[model samples]
Target: MEIIGYARVSTREQNLDLQLDALKEAGCKLIFEEKVSGVKDRPELDKALSYLREGDTFVIWKLDRLGRSLKDLVYIVDCLQKRKIAFKSIVDGIDTNSALGRCQFGIFASLAEYEREIIVERTRAGLQAAKERGKLTGRPIGLSEDAKRKAIAAKRLYENRDYSIDEICRILHIGSKATLYRYLRYEKVRLMNRRNK
Candidate 1:
């Protein structure tokens, strides 16, 4: 049976060298490495899971490296068990093929779910308190007040026919003509509606 290893780090700046070396020393025939946050989707991890087969072993350097939530980790282990594939976490000393390991996994999973629920509850309470205080929880993304002003300036410059679209982009530090056009389209709609009124 082949041994497949997976390793992950939360950020792109983080290194996977240590986990790679450990997995290699552990006799991993193939290893998948991903540089992304646990909350983000991992294409490499999906590929590794897809490559698994009966009698093959799945390995990881740590439990958290395998998945963000304990529930997700447990689900992965359960799938492996159903497939007759073994699972191991080198750092955590967890092996799903053993009785003791299975018991420990259940306990760990339950505690993790409990902790997650507590965090969710506290976050909701905090958001409610902030709302009561008339504070926004977070700022909106994309074009803001400053961007709208710049977009309006770009439209005015464009209508003057003195500068090309490219020149307008350069002047405003806009990324592309396409993005500027999107903003222009919105403004065009707003202008049309005002005239219709």
Candidate 2:
């Protein structure tokens, strides 16, 4: 069985020496290193994953070196497991070859799920409280200020009867006749509201 290693640093200013040295000490036969942010594409990581084979172990200095978040870590580990490739994180003491290591990974996945659920629950509760207080709990119901301005101009042009619908749309920078009609409807409603008030 072979031990393959992958190391990464978020920027060129950071050194991969520590992770590289640790992977070498761990007897990694092939090591891939890169300096890239976790949020960006990691070509070296893709290469390392492709190089791993069944009965091989993929090693990293730490779990964070392999993935940007717990969900990402779980996904990579899951893929490795499906390919019969073991995983090891030196600093994190994670080794998927043993039962305890497997359990630890499972706990990480569970924690990720639990965290997501808690966030959703808290958001729902907060929205409900806002509604109870008679506050707007969602998106505002009206055209934006810029759209309202365009709607007013379109309405005035339409009432002048000198410009065709298409001409008015072109003059007002509106996209379509349908849009111009919608804007005209908005202006009509606004004027009706003002009259009633």
In Å, residue 187's CA in model 1 sits off its true spot by 29
TM-score of 1: 0.57
Residue-wise C-alpha lDDT for candidate 1, range 149-191, written one tens digit per residue:
8878877876666777778788899899777777777567332
Give lDDT for model 2. Answer: 0.87
Model 2 Cα lDDT, one tens digit per residue, 49-125 = 99999999999999888888887889899999999999999999999999999999999989888888999999999
TM-score of each: 0.57, 0.77
Candidate 2 positional error at 84, Å: 2.0
CA lDDT, candidate 2, residue 156 = 85
